[model samples]
Target: MTRVVFLLVPQVHLLDLAGPAQVFSTAADLGLDYRTEYVADREDVPTAQGLPLRAGTEWPDLESGDLVLVPGWRSPKTAGGPRLTDAQVAQVQAHHARGGTVGSVCSGAFALGQAGLLDGRRCTTHHSLQDELARRFPAATVERDRLFTTDGRVVTSAGIASGIDLALHLVAVRHGPAAAAQIAREMVVYARRGGDAAQDSAMLRHRSHLSDAVHRVQDLIDVRFAEPLRLADLASAAGVSERTLTRRFTESTGLTPLRYQSVLRLERAEHLIAQGSPVESAARAVGFGDARMLRRLRSARFQS
Candidate 1:
């Protein structure tokens, strides 16, 4: 079983703690060997949102396959005292030294820094804390405006809801994209929200709009993106004329239907290629006739 340990702190954000917990818990429900455990400095822990929690003072046995995540807590802007004791910080250090993965959410990055884990790692936290994190940990690379970042096994998120994204990413890395995708769908989260630094994929990027017709069309396209889709069929699915569909899709997503499809195809093809698929093979897998189109799309993407 893969053990996921939450190193809970006083005043931990409920969502930051719960989001990742839910992901792994649901994964366990889906038959994955995930055993989630919570540990704290004390038996009773108070949250920033006034929710009280209970945890064990003693930590569990860990292996290299396990993960230790420190969820963020509330802190003052001014120089406040250290949140974690030196002993707790040493535990985090030892965990990484033993080759186990470690991570943080929001102000939790501060604890990792106190442990010296953030040194030379690419990490992130809540946007408001970016400057302070960088100011304190001059050795760490604080990624600004990022949803999440992974420098080797030391993953981090911007906190709160972004914690869910980081958890999904970890699931995807160890398990597979299919596992993460399944979990995201079950949780109603948009999967593959672009790169680590961006919001998400084209589907997620365009999903913020609340147009029912556009969403229906997008749903159909998401399912059959690897097929030869015609405008008429998309319009039929959206219950609109081809012209109207084109306008709505563009206005909602900032891309025409065909452009959106091309973006999706390119995104999928890139993943396949990253997994060592040949360019031609990846192109064909995403419904392209050949590598020529894929290459052009890639070139245009890079050039612009």
Candidate 2:
């Protein structure tokens, strides 16, 4: 089981905390073996929105597989969110020292910077705080206009609702795209928003439609895109005639079922190739019989 611990700060933005918590909790509910925990420096914490919350003062046992996230809080200038205590900073640093992932959203990046985890790493936070974060942490390379960024084990997100995207990205990494999609579906979020320019894949795109039949077929195809699948098989899975499936699928996603699968394969192949895999190996890994078809698809993808 993976433990997802949220380190809550005073004046925390509710959505920054709730969004990711809901994601991991929903994943747990879906039998994903995820355990969510909340820890705070004090027993009672006040939020920027004026609501009060109670959290555990005692921390839990965590390993490398576990993740610790510091949700963003109101900026220090406005209400002066308290900084992480020295001991708490030590704990956060120690977790990373032990090879565990430590993440943040918005102003929470300041806490991570206090822990010295942002040194020489590319990270981001809420746009409003980007200049201050960069000024405060001169050693850190703070990026702008990113939903989230991962450099080694330290990750950071832009802010607010983007936390959901960050949590979904983490789920997809530990599990798979299909698992993330299911959790998003259960949460009633469109599957995802692209993390960045190059990171856009079929898994994140082509999920804006509300058709139950198309979504069901997409769920199946997402999990088995690397396999040899037939039109009859896909139509049968959707419980629709081949012709009707074709029409609806096209109307919903603007791609035929087979074409959707090909897009998936092409995207995955591109990722593998970018990671230094040979053309032939990447092609075969994403379900193509040979590099010839993958090359043709690559040419077509770039041209169109």
Candidate 3:
């Protein structure tokens, strides 16, 4: 069995703890080898929602897993009494040093950051802490809009409900698509989102940039997913080479320019389709020049 530890902190968000636990439990019921336990620096930590959760194991023996999950606290922006200390930090770092994967939910990225496990890695946290997380961990790529991010041994996620999505994705990664789908069906959530989907929804945004040129290009793309967007036009307006634009675009947003634009188009098209627009019209509205191509794309995306 794969041992998964939930590292609880004071004033933890109940949903953050429950979301991933449910996913793992569902996976086990569907025949994946998994076991879950709670661990913490203290034995009784009061939660933000007015209850106390026990710290199941001592800190020394907490390293029991192929995985360690740090669920977010309710108000991570504020310093609270049950906050993880430097000692707990060291324990997690040591576990990852031995090749165990560390997973985090919402503001749980802060714990991982404290542990130095997130240094020089791609990660994310709840949108509320994007600036603070980036400021605290200069070496890490802090993504605000991504559903979740996994870089090597560390995985981080966006706010609240996204924890379940990240857990289901790990199920897909560790077990297989069939297993993940089964778990998602049981949970009544969508199956795991593709990496590109995660990037498009949460990681890429109009406001998260340092360069005016990149911002201009991204803003234009955000508004005009229905228009024909050309690399040359974007690069010309931004006053950079296509290669430089591509590199900067990916560096800032973690997505290639073309793929980023495609996501915007697809998402817009999906909204229209869901609203009962004719598929052909929706495709054209989203810059797909051919109705036949839209049909093919729609067919690939959804069976119905």
Top candidate on lDDT is 2
Per-model TM-score versus the true fold:
0.67, 0.65, 0.66
Q: Judging by TM-score against the true structure, name the best candidate.
A: 1
Instruction: Find the 10 residues in a row with the least total lDDT in model 1.
Output: 191-200
Off by over 4 Å in 3: 59-65, 80-82, 195-304
lDDT for model 2: 0.89
Q: For model 2, what is the error of residue 269's alpha carbon versus the real structure, in angstroms, after optimal superposition?
A: 20
- Report lDDT (CA) for all predictions: 0.87, 0.89, 0.79
Tens digit per residue, CA lDDT, model 2, 141-209? 988877899998999998888899999999999999899999999999954765663323477689998
- lDDT of model number 3: 0.79
lDDT tens digits, residue span 1-304, model 3: 7888889987889999999999999888877888888898778977879978887657444343478999998756666223567777877888898888998998889888888888899988877788888988899988666889889879988857888888888888888778888888999984466433444452255457787777878877887767777898889878999888988888877777777777777777776776578888888888988678667765776875
Candidates in order: C-alpha RMSD to true structure: 5.5, 9.3, 11.3
* Candidate 3 or 1, higher lDDT: 1
CA deviation > 4 Å runs, candidate 2:
197-304
**What would the per-residue lDDT of candidate 1 be over residues 145-213, giving only the tens digit for each residue?**
789988877988898888898898889988999998899898988544533545345778789998999
Clashing pairs in 2: none
Error of 1 at 117 (Å): 0.4
